[model samples]
Target chain A: MRRQLLFTALGAAIALTSPLAGAAGDELNFDAYREMLADGNPAELLEMEGEELWRTARGPKNATLEQCDLGRGPGVVEGAAAQLPRYFADTDKVQDLESRLMHCMEAQQGIPSAEIINGQFLKGERGKLAALVAYVVTHSKGKPIAIDLSHPRVKEMYDMGERAFRYRTGAMDFACSSCHSQDGKRIRATQLPNITKPEGAAEGWSSWPAYRVSNSQFWTMQHRLWDCFRQQRTAEPVFASDVTIALSVFMAGKGNGAEARWPGVKR
Target chain B: MKKLFLALPLALGLSGASADELQTRVEQMMLDSFKANGIAGLDRQKQDAVQKACSGLTPPDAETMKKLEAAEMATIKWPTDGNFTGGDWKEGQKIAASGRGLTWTDKTADNNGGGCYNCHAMDPKEVSEGTIGPSLEGYGKLRGSSEEVVKYTWGKLWNSKAYNACSDMPRNGYGGILTETQIRHVMAYLFDPASPVNQ
Candidate 1:
C-alpha cells in the first residue's frame, strides 16, 4: 500500500511540472520560425531612407545631421549609437541618441525641439527624425553595447534609473522590477525576463529600434522607453526626457559587451 | 420518492454543478467586474476557443488538442520570397530588448517593441532577464544551422499556437506585433552567429 501511494504521488508531481519542462521545446520552434523570416526585412527601406535624411540639409537653417555630434567628433557616425546615454559636456546632462538628436536639430538646424517632439513618430519632422535615427543606428549594428557611465552625471542617472526601476506604485503596485525582477514569471503566457541579472540586462538592452509585429511599425529607443512608463501606469514620459535617458544608461551600462542589434523584429 | 432520490445525484453530475461550474462562474464574475476604457475593450475579456480549452480544470484531451494545434498551424504567415534570413544582427538585437507599444494610453501605434527580454535570457553578460522561457544563452551554439531549426523558429514567432495549442507565447507574426523586416532583424539576433544571443 505504501509503494502504491508513492507511485501515485510521483505521478502527480510529474503532471504538475510537465508544463514547465515542455515550454523550452515550444520556444525553440518559435525562435526557428522567426529566424527564417530574417532576410528581406522591410525595415531596410526605412534604414535607407533614414540614411538619406541624415545627409540632406533640412529644417529652418537647412543644416544636415552629418555635422551633429553623437558623443563622437562631429560628422563621425561610426559606432556612436552603441555608446549613448552618456554625459555631453556641452549640455551638462545625460542624453541618449534621440535627445541628443533633438538638441542638434534645435541648436544646429534652428528647428524647435518642441515641434518635433509634439509630432507623432511618422508625422511631420518627427518622421524625419525617426528615419535619421534608423539610418544612424543601423550603422552601429554588430558592435557591442558600451554606454559610458564613468562620468559623475552619467553615474547619477544610472542610480536614478535603478531607483525608478524599483519604485513600485500604481493600481497593480507595479514597477519595472515587479515584472522584470523575478525569473520564470509569465502573464498570460508571455514570458518576463528577469531584468536584474546580467544576461537579462544584455538581452533587454541590446534590442531596441525593433519592429513591433503587433502594430506593424518600427520603434525607436525613445519610443520604447516611453511605452514602458505608460505600461507602468506612471505618467507618460516626456519625449527625450532625462529619466528615459537615465534608464537607458542603467540598462546599457549593465549590458556591457552584449552586441548591439538595433532595428530588431518583435512579436 | 425513490425515483427523486436517484435522480438528484444524476442531476448534480450532469449539470456540472461541482468544481467546474464554480470555476467558470468565478471566471465570469472576474470578467464582468472589469470595465473597458479607451482602446482597451470588452474583447480583452473574451477568451478564444484555445484559451477556453486551456482554462479547463484538466489539460486538454490529446485528440481535441491535436485539432487545435492544427488550426493554429494554418494561421502562420510564411514569408513570400522564401528568404528566411536577412537584415543586420546588430539591428535585430535592439528590437529584442525593447518592450514597448500597444496600450490604451498609446496615442498611436506607429512604434512598438518585441519585449523578448520579458521572457528569455539572450545574452551572457547582461544582468536583467525574465526566465519564463529557457535561457537562450548560446542558442545558435546548441542548435547548429540546420534548415529545420531555422524554419521552426520563424514559424514559432509567427504563431506560437501552431506547435503548442495553448502556448503562452504571443503570436507575434500572426497577431501583427512585429513587421516582416522587424521579424527578420530579430531572426538575425537569434541566428546570426555574430549576435550576442549566439555568443
Candidate 2:
C-alpha cells in the first residue's frame, strides 16, 4: 500500500511540475493530478469485490444477488446501468441502481433494510453495498446512458427531479444549478461539471463513482450525491430515498447517451 | 350499510385528482426524504423569496431579479460597532482559507470558515486558491480602503446576493454563516496593508 501511494505521488509530482501545468491558470493542478492517478484507479478493487458479493452466498437468506433483476431480466448484470433509475413493477416505483439493489437485498436475501442503509461505503469491506454497485456498473462501462421514460412513474420521477435540481433551499441558498448551470467555474481548483445540458450532464454523470485520491475512497453516485447535499447545507438525505432516485433520473436522463465512464479517478 | 360505507373508499379512487399530482407528491417526497442531524435542521430546506426566485429552471427576468435582490439585501445585518476591520488578520487568514463548517459532521457552529479561498483567489502565494469568484490578491493595494470601498466590501461579504441575486456565492452574514467579528477579521484580511492579500 505504501509503495502504491509512493508511485501515485510520484505521478502527481511529475504532472504538477509539467510546463502544461498552470497554463489553464489551474495552479492547484487538480486535472493534471487526476490524469496521473487515472492509471491505477482504486475503484477497480471495489469492482472485483462487488463481483464476489454478487456471486457469494453469505447473507441471512444464504442467497447471492445473481438472480436479482436490474431493469433487464433476472440475474442480468450486463448493460443494466445504462438504463437505470427506471420503473420496477414489483416495487411499483422508479428506482436507481442503488435503490433497486437495496430492494433486492431485502427481498432476495432477507437482509434487513436498516443494516444496508447504514452500511459502510468501503470497497473491500464486508457487506459494503457500494462495492456491489461498482460490480454492477462495471458491466455497463462505456455504454451510453439510456434511461427509459416509458413508464408514467418514470416521467413523474423525471419531472420531480427537474424541480428538485432547481429547488434552492438551504443556509447557502445553493441549488444544484447554482454551481453547475454556468460554464468555466471551479470551486477551489476543482472544476464543477455543468449538469444542465446533454453533453455536460453526460460528461458529468458519466465519470462518477470516481476514486478520490485525497481520501483514498471509492465513491458511488449515491455517495457523491450525499456529499453534494451535505455541501448544500441541506438535511442529510435518506439512503436511496425517492429524492435521490429522482435526482439520479434527472441527471442520468440529461446525460442520456453520454458514454458511461465508471470508476473514474479524482483528486 | 357496512358495504356502502366500504364502497366510499373505491369511490375516492374513481374520482380523479389534479394532473399536477406529481408535483404535490414530490413535495411530500422531499419532506420525507431528508432528516436533520447535528446543527442542521430540516427547516434549512425551506426556501426564502430570493432562493425561490433564483433557483428557477430558467433564469428569472431582470424585473424579478431586482425585486428579489431588494428582499435579499434587506436581510443583511451591518456591523453594530461601526468598525469592520477591528479583528485580527491572522484569525482572518484561517477563516478565509477554511472550507469546513455547518455540515452534519461538524462539531460546533461558532468556528465556521468563510471558505473564501474555496471560491476566490486570496493571497497570490496560495496556489490552491479557487477561481470561482474574482481574485482579491492585491485588494488593498489596487483599491485602497476608501469609505465607499470599505462599505461595499463589507456588504459584499455579508450578503453577496444583495448585489447579484443569483450569485453562486453564499450569503455569509444573512445566512448566519459568520459572526460579525469574523466578518470584521475578513475585512482586515482584505484591507490590511500587512496582509499577504495586498502583497
Candidate 3:
C-alpha cells in the first residue's frame, strides 16, 4: 500500500513538473524548421494538379478553363489571382477567384454553377476547381498584389466592407475588430497582425490557398473567409456572395504592393 | 581536525554557489540563442509589464489587473459609423475556417488567416478542432444579439486585452490581422440561424 502511494505521488509530481520544467526556456525554433521544409512544400503537387485541371477538357461540355479570364485577357491565368475581387464587365459584378471559376465552369464547360459550388473542396469536379485555383494562384506567386480600386463599384464595396467589418452582433457580441484591431496581441502563442496598418495589411493579405497542417487539406481564399463566420457564431455567408467579394477586395486593396504567396504551407 | 571540518563546510557552500551560477548562465544562454525574422521579431521574446508580472508568479492584485485592463481598453478603436451587425453571416463562415497567412516565409502582402479552428471548436459538426479555447458551438442560441452584447463582442475582437488584461485571445482588429468587412462577416456567421455555427 505504501509503495503504491509513493508511486502515485511520484506520478503526480512528474505530471506537475513536466510542462513547467520543459517550457522554462525553450522557445519555438520556427526559422530553422521553416528553412528545412521550404524546399519541399506540398503546395507544389497541388499546383501541378491545378495546372492540369485548367487545361484539360473534361466538363459536361468537354471544355477547358483555359479560356477563363481572371481580370486579365481571355485564356490568361498568370498573375490573375493577385488581381482578383475586381469588377468583371462580362458578369456586371465584382468576383473573386472562386466565383470566377464557377463562372467559367458554367459558361465554358457547360457545368452548372450550383453543382460545382455545392460539391466538396476535394471531391468530384469541385476538387478539380480547387486544383485549378492552386495552379492559377501559383502562377501569381511572388507577384505584387494589385487589386483595382479605381472602379466605382470597387470603392463602394470597400466602404460597404468597412461598415460590415465593424458591425457587431451575436451571443458573445463579437465583432471582427474585437480580435483584429490591435498590435502586439496574441491568441495562445500566435501573434495577431493589425489589419489597419500598411505593413500589417500587406503581411496579412497576400498568403492564401494554403494547406492547413491540422486539417491536412488545401484551403482557398473562399474557404478561409467562410470559416471566420463559423467562429463568429453568425450566419454562414453565401458561397461567392457580393459581401464576400467586397471583403476580399477591401483586404487585397489594403495589401497593395505586397508579394503574392499562394498555395502556401501553414501550421 | 578543526581545519578539516571547516574546509568541508566551505566546500558545501561553494557547491551551492556554483549551482546558482549555473542556473543563471543557462537562463542567459537560452535568451541569447533566438533570432528574429520577417514579421516575427526578437521583441516577441520580451514580455510586457503585465506578462512579466504574471510570468512564473501568482495572480496579480485586483487593482493592478484593473489598471492593465483599462490601459488595454484605451487602445480600442470603435467603429466610426456606430453600426454593429449588418454583414451577411454566410461570408463570415468562410473566414472562420481559414488558417492561412503570416509566417517567416510569407510575404508582407499576403492575407493572414484567423486560424480560429486551431484553438476553438466553432461548429458541433466539425470533428477536428483544437481545445485551446472553449467550444463556441451554439453561441448565438445561448446568447442573443443585443446592443451591449454587440459592443462587447466588438471590443473583445478589437482588443481582447480590454476585457482580460492577460487574455489568450488575440486583438484581431487592432492588430490588422483581419479587415473590418471580414469581421462583419464573422459576426454574421455567429448570429445567423442558417449559419453552420448556429446549426
Candidate 4:
C-alpha cells in the first residue's frame, strides 16, 4: 500500500541520516514496527465496506450517500475531510465529519441522527458511521489539515474548546491537558502527545479514525475522545455533541498545516 | 439558580461573552454534553476547590498553593491501628499493576487499582512502567523505613495534594479510589525487603 511504501521510504531516510543511538533511534525502530503492522490494516476492509455503502441505496429513502455534501460540495469526497469541522451554512452550525455525516444521512438518506447519537461504538448505525468515516478520511490522507476558524461561531467554539481542554474534573481530576499537555510522556507504556503544540496536535488529531490493534476495531475520532473521557473517569459524553466538536476544532485548528494520516494503524 | 446563570448567556448568544463568561459557557456546554451512565454520574464533572485552583492555564500562586495543600492535608486519614506497611506486598503488587476501576464498566468502587504502575516504576525489571511520576524501583532500599519516611509516605498516598497542590498523581485515599487495606498493601510493596521493587 502507499502508506507502507511511504513508511518504508521514511524509515530508510531516517536510517541514512541519524546515527542509531538513544531515544531517536528507538523511535525509528518503533516506526519500523508500526510500518510492519500498518501493512494491510484491518480498517482497509471497513473502508471497502464504506465505499460500497456510500454507493448503495439502503436507507429509509433508498438513497445512496453519493450526493452527500462533505463541505466540498455534494459528492465531493476528495480532500473534503481535510477541511472539516468547518462552518456549515445549511445547518447554521460548525460540524466535524461524523456530525456532518449525521446531517447528510438524515437529509439525503432519510436516516435519523438519533440512530447514531444513541448508538454504541462499532454496533448498529455507529458501526456503519465508522466505516463511512474510514472511507472519507482515507481521501484526505497526506493532505494538510486546514480547518477554518474565521467564522465568529467557530472562533467562539475554538476558545471554549481551549478552555475545555484545561477544565479538570471527575474523581481523578483530569482534563485532556493532564495526559496531553506534555511531550514525550506516557500513560503506562502508551505514548501521549502534547496537543498544546502544533506537531503534537496534528499527531493526536490527524492520525486517528485509526484501526486499534488491541481491540481489533476501527475507532473514529469521536470514539477515541469518548474513551479518553471515560479513562479520565468522567461521565459519558453524548455522541457528536458541540463540546466534542469544539474540542475537535481546537485540535484541528492548532494542527493546521500538518499532514493528515487518517485511518492510521495503532496499538 | 447556578444553572440559569450559566445558561443565560449561551441562550442569547456567546458572541459578546467575556473570557470568564466564555469559560462559564464551556462549563455549561460540558454539563450539557455528558450524561450519567452506570455508576459514573454527572456529578463527577463538578470540580472541588483544589481541582479548580489547579485547572487554570498556569499553576496557582504560591500562597494559594500552600493554602490548598494545607486544606488537602487536613483530609488525610492516618491508619487507625498506627501500623503502616503491615499488609502483604504480593497483594499490593497486584493493586499497583492494575489500571482498572472508577470507569463506567466497573461494577464496584471497592475493587479498584492504585494505578501506581501507570505513572511510576515499581519493580526495576518492569520495562512498561510510566514516567509521569518519579521511579520508585528501590523505594525501600534508597529511603529506609524511618518514622519520618513512613509517615510522609502514608500522607502522600492518602492525599498527594497534601504535599504538592497541583500534583498529577491521584488522591488514592482521599478520592476513595483505594481502600485503607489496599493502601497498606501498596506501602508494604514499596517498603518490604522481599518485594520485587526492593530487589
**Top DockQ model:** 4
Per-residue error for B148 in candidate 4, Å, reads 1.6
> Which model is ahead, 2 or 4, in terms of lDDT?
4
Can you list the residue pairs that collide in candidate 4? none
Instruction: Name the lDDT value of residue B72 in candidate 4.
Output: 96
Best candidate (score: TM-score):
4
**DockQ for each model:** 0.03, 0.40, 0.02, 0.44
My TM-score estimates for the predictions, one after another, are 0.54, 0.87, 0.54, 0.91
Report the lDDT tens digits of candidate 4 across residue range A159-224: 888988998888888899988998788777678889999999999999898987555678999999
| Ordering by DockQ | 4, 2, 1, 3
What is candidate 1's lDDT per residue for A1-267, written digit by digit as tens?
A: 643553355345435443334454345223343353355344666788888887888778988888888998897778999988788889987888888888988888888999986766767777777777887788789998887655556665675566556544322123577567676575423555677777788777877787654465778878877666557534445567555676678788888888987777654
lDDT (10s digit) by residue, model 3, range A73-143: 99988889888878888998878898898999899988898887556557876777787888888889899
10 residues in a row with least lDDT, candidate 2 chain A = A118-127
What lDDT score is found at residue B124 in candidate 3? 77
Error of 3 at A7 (Å): 40
Instruction: Grade the docking of candidate 1.
Output: incorrect
**Candidate 3: docking tier:** incorrect
- List where candidate 4 sits over 4 angstroms from the true fold: A1-30, B1-14
Q: Which pairs of residues have clashing backbones in candidate 2?
A: none
